[model samples]
Target: MSPTHTDVPMAPAELDPCGMPDHPDCGIRDVLDRVGDKWSVLVVVELASGPRRFGELQRAVDGISQRMLTLTVRRLERDGLVTRTVYPTVPAQVDYRLTDTGASLTHLVKALADWSLRHREAIAASRHLYDQTHPDHDIR
Candidate 1:
């Protein structure tokens, strides 16, 4: 038997837990890892409306520390999902806006957010029951 592709030996398109192809160097996984974090989702949604400065994003993304925001945008920039621009001003203003790829991802993000909202109460109840049944451990 031979591997399907030899680019990354022993790594071929295989289903992951999420049903996405599980393989080393899989671009899908690479993209998901970059934008699948909660911070990434929130950041992308916040910028979906338009570009925002660092402080604006910090405020828009509740509970996100400035440091985490910095890291998130940096990752997005590296992924080509967002653009970070600096302008010469009194304080050298910085702004972030979604790239075409990032804009394309907003619909997916919104769908996931909507699903979470729709199932919030059910999920809460499930969590409560699970916690009661497994008091000795944290499922999270």
Candidate 2:
């Protein structure tokens, strides 16, 4: 039987943690459109090190608001990419870890990061040139 939404895996809520929606035209461009945000990439990288508590993840990711983090975690969990474990304690604690599926995407994320780092200067130069050519427009 074909999977329904409930039967389908979930991704982190805040972002498209599974990368993108399933469809015939779900090309790489579509996947990028879904989870290509800077925040999503950073979160994945941070989670790759190991499981982390909500606060820890927030701190690790940098500049992510609490709401955003919560949403992101939810999406990841729904997508079946991230697993959440809650431990009962004096104040209750929750940790998030990447599932095997999520871990599989780490290499792609890392490669993207590496490529960005390598081409940052060139990208900056391109932006500068574009700005100079079109003073009234910001093409970045």
Top TM-score model: 1
lDDT of 2 by residue, 1-140 (tens): 23342243444435324444564343555356535667667778999999999889999887998777876777677667789998989788889999998899899999988999999999999988888889998555
lDDT, candidate 1, 1-140, per-residue tens: 24432122232334234344554444665567768988999999999999999999999999998667877887788778999999999979999999999999999999999999999999999999999999998569
TM-score result, candidate 1: 0.80
lDDT of 2 at 132: 87
Superposition-based RMSD of candidate 2 using all C-alpha atoms, in angstroms? 7.8
Show where candidate 2 strays beyond 4 Å.
Answer: 1-34
Best by lDDT: 1
lDDT of each: 0.84, 0.77
